[model samples]
Target: MQLNKQNLTAFAGKLPCPDYDRGHLQTGIVHIGVGGFHRSHQAYYVHQLLKDGTPEWGITGVGLREGDRAMAEVLQAQDGLYTLVNQRPNGTNSSEIIGSIRDYLLAPDNPDAVIQRMAHPKTKIVSLTITEGGYNLNAATEEFDLTNPDVQYEIAHPQEPRTVFGYLAAALRKRKAGGHPAFTVLSCDNIQHNGNVARRMLLAFARHQDPELAGWIEKEVTFPNSMVDRITPVTTPEVSEYLFREFELEDGWPVVCEPFIQWVVEDNFVNGRPPLETVGVQFVPDVSPYEKMKIRLLNAGHSVLGIPGALHGHPTIDACMRDKVFAGFMRAFMDQEVTPILDPVAGIDLEAYKDQLEARFANPNIRDGVGRICSESSAKLPKFLQPTLRENLRRGGEIHRATFILAAWCYYSDQRHNEKNEPLEILDERAAQLHRAAAGTTTDPISFLRQESIFGDLSEQPRFVEAYTEAVRLVYDRGDVRSLMADW
Candidate 1:
């Protein structure tokens, strides 16, 4: 049978779907960005409440961008019922039907509906999984871009909002005028200090509309920073086909992810929240230690190898992991460079965490695309890789390997052909500008580094300048990543 709420009992009897009654779920949370990550991670935990026969908190997912239209339709068709496949490297897999999302609002189609859903008293938390660049942060200053065109439009047209920032600020304003309590704003994106970043950007947008409302948000609303981990790839037709052929269940948009998942959140909320600790969530007084560990090791580790992996003509992270040189570079990059900067996380054995991360990256079943990791290199490198670069400079540490990462990305920007001389895709919005900056790499080695927004003061730092110059020279001379690794 096709996946939908109407088939709940019958499907559960035939397949391993949710065992609890579907009618008991009530919308207590409104999650923005109904992407693969949100479904596989946050919604999975909320769905667990139903499986445990305590279905109080269902989710109302809001689609804020153009890419979300198809997702909105799929969930709306299925009554928010979709399959989740947890594939492991050890060749074992399991499937479950997650039933936490009760409704969806494609904001572009119906803006008022999105605002009303968020403004509703029962929607205690508004969570977001929009990617790093979606926050509209200024690349150079790392501050909220108040002058962004969308933000500007929202400032003027408060009632008719466009961006997520606008919708959130407007909805909160409505709740305040109605004398309803403020709801907590939660960020589930992989950005560094995600909660604080959300609070900063949200208030900035709100202040533009009404300064009083912004101040109220600053004082009343709780933005809990969280660290969420799950290797969820974009759902391809292959996944849907697999489900239909294997299980005789045709889920329109099933999420395929690795078996592992983790969420570490701050215990700060204006209204009540789910008992997330019941599902292995670490609710801590401070999320910094945990956040730093994840941002550096996992996110940073991805950046450390992303471009080099792509340049090696590898399609997925598992392929990169299978290459001895790529695998060696990751281990050295993590253990020697990233581990030194990270503080001792509470209850975490850093060594074991590093080993587990390596295993997860090498998981062949997940098939996370290297091209996907290379997509927002401009935004990601600054947040994920540059911190390590900056810290290594501050502490007078070796920067040869980190310097190679920068060079690899610059080279990757100019590469439109594979080793076989066939056309290859460079999947970045900034591809044109980056290729322009990478013009004459051998003759003008520092041109790419001169991008102030990306490299900032690193161009002026003597230590990095010397290391980067050498690294770029070495990669260009050998013309192969394998040789570069061998020399290192």
Candidate 2:
């Protein structure tokens, strides 16, 4: 049976299907960037609320880029229904069909339609999962990049908006003009204080277009900070094949993830919000401690293993964890360097959270790729790893393992291949610049650290420079990351 609204009855006996009638569902939320993580995390949470008889929070997904056309095709063909498979550490599988997404619109195809949907009075919340770099903030100034060509175009022609900020500013302007109340802007990205970042970027863009409109948004709108956690990998053809072979369900783009999921959100909204708190969503007064803890530990832990593990030719995170030396290095980096910098997260046991992260990484069934974790290091390291290094430098803490990881990244960027000589696909936006810096490592020794946008004067710090120089020398001279990690 195919996965669609019509086939829910067919999948009922085999897997968990939506129990409510989706036809009567209304759209109260407009979510941008409908990727695997959105489907598995935010969409999944909304699906739970739908199952509990709250039909007002159905989502209308918007895809801004041309790459999102593929997802648009899949979800539209499936009648906004898709299968979500949870791979457990114990080798068991659980699957469910999520039905909260009522419609999808590719913005490049019809930008006006997308804006009008958000301007509608019923759409109370506009959410985003547009990745860390999607906000278009300048790295040094941490302000919206008004110099971007697309942003300039959007500012010149707001009616034909091409970016998220453009569309948001246009829609909010319409809402204010039509005497409609402003909707809450919720950001579910992994960045610390994501809501604040979103608000700043959007306001910068809005002010560039119209100062009066920007003031209205600042006074009326609320960007609720949120921390969303899930281990959803890219949906490969093998995943679709597995769904077909095991459950006889032909899904074009089914999402697969680990069995762990979490969402901690600030309880602040302008218009009415969903009863998400009743569905395992923690609605707290402050989300800073929770966001800080997750980013420093789980996200940084991935980088600690991913950079060296990729150089050592580990295919997946589980493969790295299978090696005792890599596993020990991961734990040591967290306990010695990261844990000390974190503030006390209310009601969370730090040690137990660390244990849970280890178990999640070691789950063989998840097959979370090392390349995926290492792809966008330029953007990720600034947020995830560098903060810990900055804090450690101030307090004089252990920086050996963290410094070595940076060395491993330089070598990885320079070589672009594993020990086995197989090419590692470098996917960062700054790949060319990274390779250029890494090429000068032999002569300068700290050339890679000189990328001021990334390192931000850390190269000039004596302690960091000493540790980095030693680590880079070892990486090149010995040519064995596993042995270096074991000895460290």
Candidate 3:
């Protein structure tokens, strides 16, 4: 049987949304980067909102990339319907037919359709999950790369666009021209101060196009900070088949994640907003503290463990968690390198927080890929890993562990040496630079850190450079992460 909109009805028996009222659901939100994470995390949350009440927050997913046509086709056939399975080690808890996604627009295939939706006055929130690298930024300069041909073309032809920032800026220009107030630009990426980054990119695009329009957005728009956490893994063939058999039907984009989910958002919206607070979303004065702990601890933890585990022949996060040495290394690294710098947010217990992370990683049913977490390391490290490194060094703390992290990062980016001694695939913007750097020993850690764009001004720190250099030599010479880590 072909999986389509109606096939979702088969799942109703397994997980019910009896109270869900689709008629009341309004298209109030527009989401960019409607990938697996958004479907599993943000889309699931909004689905809960509709299932309980407040159907006014349904999402219209926008695929920013040209090649995202397959996703568009799948969602369109299903009427934006999909399943969300919360997997635990013991069992599974599934949601039947998440109907929060009302529509989808593949921007390359249907640019006009996307623009029309963006221009709608009813759409009050423009949220994003364009990933760390999708922002089309020069990580070193912390600015939009207008030099990017995609961005340049969008700038040249404002009537049509390609990049996320371009599409957003063009839509805002339409809204401004029509005398419609700008909707809030809510960023849900893993980066720190993501809202500010989004605003900066958008403003940069706008200023280049029209100075007055940039000022207008600065006055009318609100970019609210948010902290979103959920362990959503990429769907595998085995997992997908399991879900299909378990549900008694097919689901093309089922989101399998850990049972735990959280969203801490600032209450800032233009036109209107969702009653997300009703659905357990914490509406706080500031999401900064929560953001800090999540980015520094959980996100950084993933990056820290990613390459080490991958090279150690562990394919899944759970497998890595079960490794006694790796597990302790993570805990100790967090305790020594990351945690002290975290100012407790809203009485959050630092010790208990660490305990929860252990449990989250140990969820056996959730098969998070090291490669997935490991993607875009160059972009992710600046936000997720660099802060902790800087804080520890500033206080004259041990950086040997953090330096090993950088070395592992260098090795991973080099993307070589599978267990079979074959080449591991590299997927990043700076593959060539990394490949060149990886050929010889990165004995001088400063050489890697000196990439001012990624490390910012931190490369100039004498102590940090020393620690990084020492760690690099240790890893290169020893050629064993576990042994080097154990000694540390």
The estimated TM-scores of all candidates read 0.97, 0.98, 0.95
* lDDT-superior candidate, 1 or 2: 2
Candidate lDDT (C-alpha), each: 0.85, 0.92, 0.79
lDDT of 1 at 189: 91
Top lDDT: which candidate number?
Answer: 2
In model 3, residue pairs whose N, Cα or C atoms come closer than 3 Å (at least 3 residues apart or on different chains), thus clashing, are: 25-55, 140-453
- Who wins the TM-score comparison? 2
| Candidate 1 lDDT, 1-488, residue by residue in tens | 77887766666654577767677777789999888899999999888766776566789999988778999989999998889989889877788888889889899898999999899888899999888888898767877887788888888988889898888888899899999999999999988889999999888778778899999899889999899999898788988888777777889899999988999999999999999788788899999988888888898888776677777778888888888888888889888888888888879999999999999999988888887788878878888888887999999876778889998788777666554565557766677888888776778888888888778888899989888888888777766876687668
Candidate 2, residues 236-297, lDDT tens digits: the string is 78888888888899999999999999999999999999999888999999999999999989
* Models ranked on lDDT: 2, 1, 3
Q: Candidate 3, which segments miss by more than 4 Å at Cα?
A: 1-3, 17-24, 91-95, 419-422, 442-446
Model 3 whole-model lDDT (C-alpha atoms): 0.79
